[model samples]
Target: MNKPLLLQAQRPFTAFAVRATPLATLCLVALLAGGCASPSYTITPEMQARAASENPAPPKDDDFPAPGSAKWQQGAFPSLEALRAMRTGMGKDQVRGLLGFPHFSEGLAGVREWNYIFHFRTGAGPDYITCQYMVRFNADVLTHGMYWKGAGCADLLKPPPAAMQPVATVRPTVVAPAKTTLGADGLFRFDGRSLDDLLPEGRRKLDALARDIRSDSGSAGAIRVTGHTDRLGSKPYNQALSLARANTVRDYLVQAGVPAQRMQVQGRGESEPKVHCAQARRAELIDCLAPNRRVDIEVLSGQ
Candidate 1:
């Protein structure tokens, strides 16, 4: 009220904004522009390899290989023998399971080498392997692919040998046991045509005898085991082999239910042969070689 406060404050009024420095403004614009740049980028070969080095990359088998471009036919698969079993021109699916995926392709047909490598668990470290298979194709169809794995890859190209003998279960029946007594030497000689093919009864009887003796200590006293074989092989070998078999029978008997302390074992191989031809055909052919190959187990009061 005193003269309308004639003092209109004498302070000056200035603009409310502070101007930015050119250098600072320039820095800010540059940073924003850099951040807004495009994310799209072209990957170089070297960059791709660097990334691959950090992680393993799967093998490539996409489009059909160019005819002249060195490429092994089909995919990696099983053993050469197994692959050879497949008919020519088989589809990829037919041989898929028989052999697994092809490892890697080698060069073109002429001396082309492919290694379908795999690992097997053995005593040693992983069984390192590389199998080179040769595939010969006529036109577009695959004629035949010589498959072999491991060293000597070229060998797989050849034909495998035919099995001559009746391998596995196809073997001929050389001897079928029957019950028949041999010479008067108190031995067994079963008709096996050969000494090697002795029946179980000859050995099983001794085992039983040993068990019976072992169970009863009284029988263990004066235990005498006599062994015999068919009329084959040298006197010494046959006798020794017979004795060993007899001892084995005795040991088995002892293990089954016989006392080791009260047991005796012996052998007399091939000293006797099957005099009774008829009995040799049956399962209990022991009588045929009873005297020849046998183990006489006698228990007496004295050991």
Candidate 2:
């Protein structure tokens, strides 16, 4: 081989050795530090909230409020009167009127059951402990209800009276329902379902009806309003619309002097139609089905 060729090969070897020396030194340093290095971190509420936004966090037993917190009291809870009003075979609307909505509406075993959360003091130093109330339904009718197992549910039911009252020998009041049915067309425009949708004549009629109800009943008692819709929409949609309409009427009645405790509302949807529309698809079909869309109001006549 020529001497110049030998020099050319030697130059490449020198450069490689220089590059390898630095990389080997770095590897040695890293290996030495790896054994003694310790890392620590703090997680703040900000971090927790960020993590929550990225993933669903299931509720924990620890989520129960601390003792003496505002939530520990009976805020937004079913009252004693509501609990007493509940009865077997009552409709969903009636139950809702008694206890408001269930606390946990994500019913177990499908949509046939509902769970309500409540808290009560045990005086045993447990503070306001959490409990559950459960109700089961068959179709739209209530079947039964249950209290949280082993949670002293019965004790809360008949709590000790705050004070004693002199026993009075007086007859109890008796109340009966007086039903009234009104056509929806007179109250609403087409498919409207809000208080704002009340026609002028409808307002007058409702005012008169409210007066009649108060006069006929002699006292403001339990009021029940059931809303209906024509068979022109899906069941779920019609049900929701009918419920909205019923709520509107209920609110108006309450504003007009009916006691909220005495009011219950239901949405019958297209289930109880007064007349059947023929198969001919015409404008007349909707008008012919008008009788199906209506509201039924019932007030308790007291004695």
Candidate 3:
């Protein structure tokens, strides 16, 4: 009896060893030692009944872990690619390859259900939302059904819409500046300088010009109506007469629907001549200088 003396342990140490340990802790230790086998849970009818109930509570007996429990709290931040890789009929190992182990305490082997907590980015900086996901297995333990606890969470797993293409802009057409010459003889009576003195042909030509201007109004710019005379009258008198004739033509054009603001009038009495007559006879000179007495209308294009 003296040779077999009992070994005495400290009272504090004995109390620490007597505390109850969780089954998960024992399984974890066995797994580390490579001696633990994957466990299977028999799905009792009562368990199925509870799962099918409206507003069912968190499952007990290792069916489902309560929210904020140690197993449920172990969440993962999975990428969009990983979430998209999940599909039906995948084996437990394949599912585990993409999304790690279940966040809940469901065993690894022969598990009919796996629940997880996944965090997804909201695409607004670093903002993210936590979602609960569940995967159900068939009798062969292959994945068959997937579900989400939150509304709109499933939509996040789908791809985004395509980008829009830009449209080209069209430019307006611009007509070049053009100059038209009208004989004063055709436009008015001899020595005419007023609207009353305008000949019928002159009024008709002016009407046609107005129509052209109106048709190109969108691209039409400034219009210049210039009057020229033959070298027959005094410089000042010719100048005044030319100016008056130009004004009359411009007024007629305005009344014919050409914009008044876009038109300007000028007179160049005996200044610019198209032909210089050498004839000495008055009638011959008048006829020869006919080209010099005329009205020039120049229309400019839009900028």
RMSD of each: 30.8, 18.0, 37.1
Q: Write the per-residue lDDT of candidate 3 for residues 185-210, one digit (tens) a residue.
A: 99989888778899999999988877
Best by TM-score: 2
User: Residue 128 CA error for candidate 3 (Å)?
Assistant: 72
> Residue 278 in candidate 3 has what lDDT?
88
TM-score of each: 0.28, 0.44, 0.42
User: Scored by CA lDDT, what does every candidate get?
Assistant: 0.41, 0.62, 0.70
Model 1 misses residue 92 by how many Å? 50
Between prediction 1 and prediction 2, which has the larger TM-score? Answer: 2
Q: List the residue pairs that clash in candidate 3.
A: none
Which ten-residue region of model 2 has the weakest summed lDDT?
A: 31-40
Off by over 4 Å in 3: 1-177
Q: What is the TM-score (0 to 1) of candidate 1? A: 0.28
lDDT of 1 at 135: 33
Q: Residue 24: error of model 3 in Å?
A: 99
